[model samples]
Target: MKFADIGLSDELLRAIDESGYNEATPIQAGVIPSVLMMRDIIGIAQTGTGKTASFVLPMIDILAHGRARALMPRSLILAPTRELAAQVAENFEKYGKYHKLSMALLIGGVQMGDQVKALEKGVDVLIATPGRLMDLFERGKILLTGCNLLVIDEADRMLDMGFIPDIENICTKLPATRQTLLFSATMPAPIKRLADKFLSNPKTIEVARPASRNENIEQFLVKTSERGKRDTLRSLIEAEDIKTAIIFCNRKTTVRELAKSLQRYGYKAGEIQGDMDQSSRTAELDRFKAGTINILVASDVAARGLDVKGVSHVFNFDAPWHPDDYVHRIGRTGRAGAQGRAFTLVTPSDDEAIDNIQKLTGYKIPVHGGGAPAVDVAQPDRDEAEAEPRRGRSARGGRGKAAAKAEKAPARPAPVAEARPAKPREDRKPRNDRKPAPRHDDLDGPDDGWNGPMPGFLSVGFDT
Candidate 1:
């Protein structure tokens, strides 16, 4: 449906048109009307389905006529990460440009002074991460009593980051009569409980099945050894027709290392991870969106709520530990009704992780090279068996060469041993009267005298 059919104001429709979107996405179409009517909402849709605009557009129109009081915001949007909060704030700016709605961003990795100042001046919309918002609230820098609309974006992510308690605390601080909206890619048990407790008889709108894969994305699992992952990834990047891509790693260190490796290989790559400051992360994301870097290596921080358009592919450098993450990571591509591809490098150790993803998504991902999955434990045994004959042949050749060299050399005299019986203790010499044993080094030449027959074990022979 078009934005005009969603009952948005003429000014908001104009902004939407200017933003090059006439029709509303599924989530947006299902949500904007409920939000405009001041009804509670529980929206479940995968990432990149325009979930941000569903609430942002309606909230702008709802707050356009309200007067924001000092230390209090007319609407509150709680995001899981600093990047996601900033993205939501950007959406507000982009879609609310035609209106005079004031906005304030409260997130970590930056000074709280500016945020406090913004609160003192009042804001129509306040976008924040749970931690930073809680920090400011504890210091009395902000107030939630005046907020009548509360949106908990990325609810499942909040649960994963252990921010549910903070969200509940924030909810208690707000007016009980407020209209709350909870949006997530999947409605897990905890997220469902959160919505049940906070939202009052909310209209649950699920555009697609929870954790469903986008049909526009062609997903493949690339089998690779742990040591061969980088080489395989480079080969894929070079072989595929990529416009832009995001490579996801489980750890921030991996993200940094992968990004550096890609750059060394002459690919325009950048990284964004939790260790980086907010400004640095924002700069890296800006570089990615502006095409300064065609590939972005990132941690789970960018797995959700990052809206970069025209991403042609997504490469899972490390299979995500959580099944939900696989969905979100791949969802980075195939966005906005665009066709894209996703390749996940699965090592032997990632069997469990890949299995969990397939189970969650209810479909097995096709193998990249058209063979069985790569997590076979017996492969090493087969490799060792194939190498055994070569090892045996090498050993035989070495022995033959040694035997030939020995045959060419002159034979040395064989030493003999006497078969004398043990002497009686009385006939033994005293310790002080005993002579020193002859040292082998004392003799200038090999002994020519034979004491007795040579021992059979002392003879050397080769395998003929």
Candidate 2:
């Protein structure tokens, strides 16, 4: 159905039209109505399912009449990462352009003074990451008591990043009677518990099974050694003809390393992690979106809430610890009604991890063995894998054949059996020259079975 069918304001409908989204995604269709009714909601859907608009549209309609007080927001949206918060803020601008709803973003890596100034100007909508929100609240820069609409987006990722505590803290500061909306791609027990704690009796909306991937994405897994992961990534970028893509790494360090490796290979690649300044990160993302940089190597921080268009591919250089993250990572592509592809490099040890990812996505990632990659095929480093240091060099020393032979000798030519086989056992005096071994009973207890019935003589005498 179209946005109008969901009873959105004309302004929002026009904004949706301008954005080129006439039909609402199943998630938006399911969620908007319940939200309009002012009922709390729990929305579970995969990424790229148009979840941001599901709540944003309804929020703009509800918040249209409210006037926010200085340093006090009328509605609050908490995201797990800065990119997502910024994305939400952009949505507010896009969908709320006709309405005079003011919004401010409170996220780290950005200028706090500007955010503070925005908060001072009074905001009808506030989008923030958990950490920065807490900092502002603690420092008296923003107040939550006036917030009437609460949204916890990407709840599963929040739990992954340990933001649940800050989320709970923010919840306590907000009005308990507020409308609460929680959305996630996957729901583990912890996320469920957090939802149960925050959301009142709520309308549950799920357009698809949790942790499932979009059919628009064609997924593949390439088995490669750790030494070849970078080469494979480079080749995948070149072979896939990736116009733009986000390369996911498990660690920030790996992200930097991979980004450097990509740059070294003459690819327009940049890195984004938690450490970079906000301007640098924003510039890199803008370059990516503007097509100046075709590749972005990032940690899980970029896994969610990033809405870059035309991401033709997603590369997972390291297997994510949570399979749910795999879904979010690939969701970056295959968006905006476009077909996208995702490639993952797997090592022998990642078999279980890759299996878990498949279990989460509801389909096995097709295995692509060495051949022309659907993307460019970069030659693998034949000696790299063997060159890296092995984990915990064996205490026994290197096991090369030469080393083994040097450490052992052909059974020392067994001395020829003495020609005097006539020697009898008696003639061979007691071979064991050591003292006689103690008897079993002497070492343990008396052989007599009845000894346990009475106190031992040694015990009675010692007592006396």
Q: Give the number of the best model, judged by lDDT.
A: 1
CA deviation > 4 Å runs, candidate 2? 369-464
Q: lDDT tens digits, residues 157-246, model 2?
A: 988889888888888888879899999988899988987888889888988899776889988888777656767766666566768888
- Give the residue spans of candidate 1 off by over 4 A: 372-464
TM-score (all chains, Cα) for each model:
0.81, 0.80
Worst 10 residues of 2 by lDDT: 450-459
Winning candidate number (TM-score)? 1
Give the TM-score comparing model 2 with the true structure, all chains together: 0.80
Q: After best superposition, candidate 1 residue 8: deviation in angstroms?
A: 0.8
lDDT of 1 by residue, 1-464 (tens): 98989999999999899989999999999999989888999999989999999999999888889698999898899999988899899888898899999899999999988889999999999999999899988898888999999999999999999999999999999998999999999989988888888889999999999998799999999888765677778878888999999999999878887788788789999999999998999999999999999999999999998889999999999999999999999999999999999999988899999999999999899997778534433223232333446667465554444564677779988788887998989999889998555444332433347344444433458788
**Candidate 2: clashing residue pairs, number:** 4
The whole-model lDDT of each prediction reads 0.88, 0.83
* Model 1: per-residue Cα lDDT at residue 303: 94
